[model samples]
Target: MADKSLSVYKYMCKYVVGTENHIKTIRLMNTFTDNLSSNNIKVTITSGSFGEGLQMVGSDLDIMLVDTTIDVHDEIKSIVFNPTQTNFALMTEDIKAGFAMLRFISSPNPAIRKICEKFKGSNYLSNALFKKSFLSELCPVLHGPCISDKSGHLDFAHCLHSKYWVTSASQWTMRSNNSWPNESTKQMIIKYGVLFVPIGSKGSNNEDLEWRMSFSVGEKFLIYTFSHTQLLVMHS
Candidate 1:
């Protein structure tokens, strides 16, 4: 990746900046639009740019459909997400259902029954990651106002923290030879932080060596964290 291309690519991918998956997502979104319209549902992206990030290799596509008629209330509640039972045959139904579904998915105070019905029943990382992106940015990129108008920025932070913990925890568990679920390379994200700081040590120590060896090959975790941190800090 050339320096100029790298800069362009960073902007290209809002979160998981990459080229391959972004194209794949665009195709998928087009397909979804065709299918939804064929079924009389009008769909459009509200926040995210399709084909702008790393695509999940073998994950389902999670999309939010909004109806054009439903009145988007100001008070955003997180207890109405329902995909299994919520029929999305038309645009109108999808908007209402999608909003409710999102609220349910991201609600700190979620409805157990609804959550279990939708999220718990599914285990697809692609759609889950897509949802995470949309919710993180609060922009739908599908239709209507972004998710930000309803919820605060906490959703984005929580999403990042969750991804980081899942990835880092997996790596830590694997090195310790512990089989506590999702060993090293799960669908979750990986983030690297300085786990060991020497106490006036001259240079790298055993701990540093071990950490470097474990993460030297792929520093995406470190890269993403630092990059995003810098951007956010500067903006703030």
Candidate 2:
């Protein structure tokens, strides 16, 4: 049997985070797409821009570039993946042909890996939010096949609602509470990365800061914490 409270929470998320942030995310996606085109990337941008906030603060503008040929490594470094973890750079002519069809990988499933919903329809409102501790709002997709994988792009965009972001929020809660054992949790705290936090609308002037989490690729685990909430992810 499912817990009734969870349904309430899902409904709340759909209304507060989904309905509200979705609009702002769409606008941001359009602007980001235009910016990519101007850069001559011949790419498509999808929106992974929703969270507890309605795109007001701490929301990620995750996009994908496809349909053109470019160096996968260069594109990964310049746009898709966060490079603060390493200083590796791509070669100039690395952006050559025959690498047009590739898919962006978003990991850490929210439903099982992090949030465990005991209720039928109700789930943690933060279950599917993206961690943007080190992510900048603007991601430039430099090149690939934006045509064939259009649906895949959109699917990837919405997947954040069920995966990476939620895991991020949970990890954030775990770190703040010191729930993880020993010094391991300390190392996972994002000191030099950008993080995503959810905010609520306070009319048109203020926004309520809600759930958020931080992550780094080298930490080997995710850490996050909040009042009465704690979560952690360990690499095996």
TM-score each candidate: 0.20, 0.20
Tens-digit lDDT track for model 1 on 112-189? 223222323531112123333444334433211223323232111111101122222344534442432233432232
Q: By summed lDDT, which 10 consecutive residues of candidate 2 come out lowest?
A: 227-236
lDDT of 2 by residue, 86-152 (tens): 1111122221221111122222332322322222242322211222221233422211111122222
Question: What is residue 88's positional error in candidate 1, in angstroms?
Answer: 19
Candidate 2 has what TM-score? 0.20
Q: Model 2, 217: alpha-carbon shift in Å?
A: 24
Candidate achieving the largest lDDT: 2
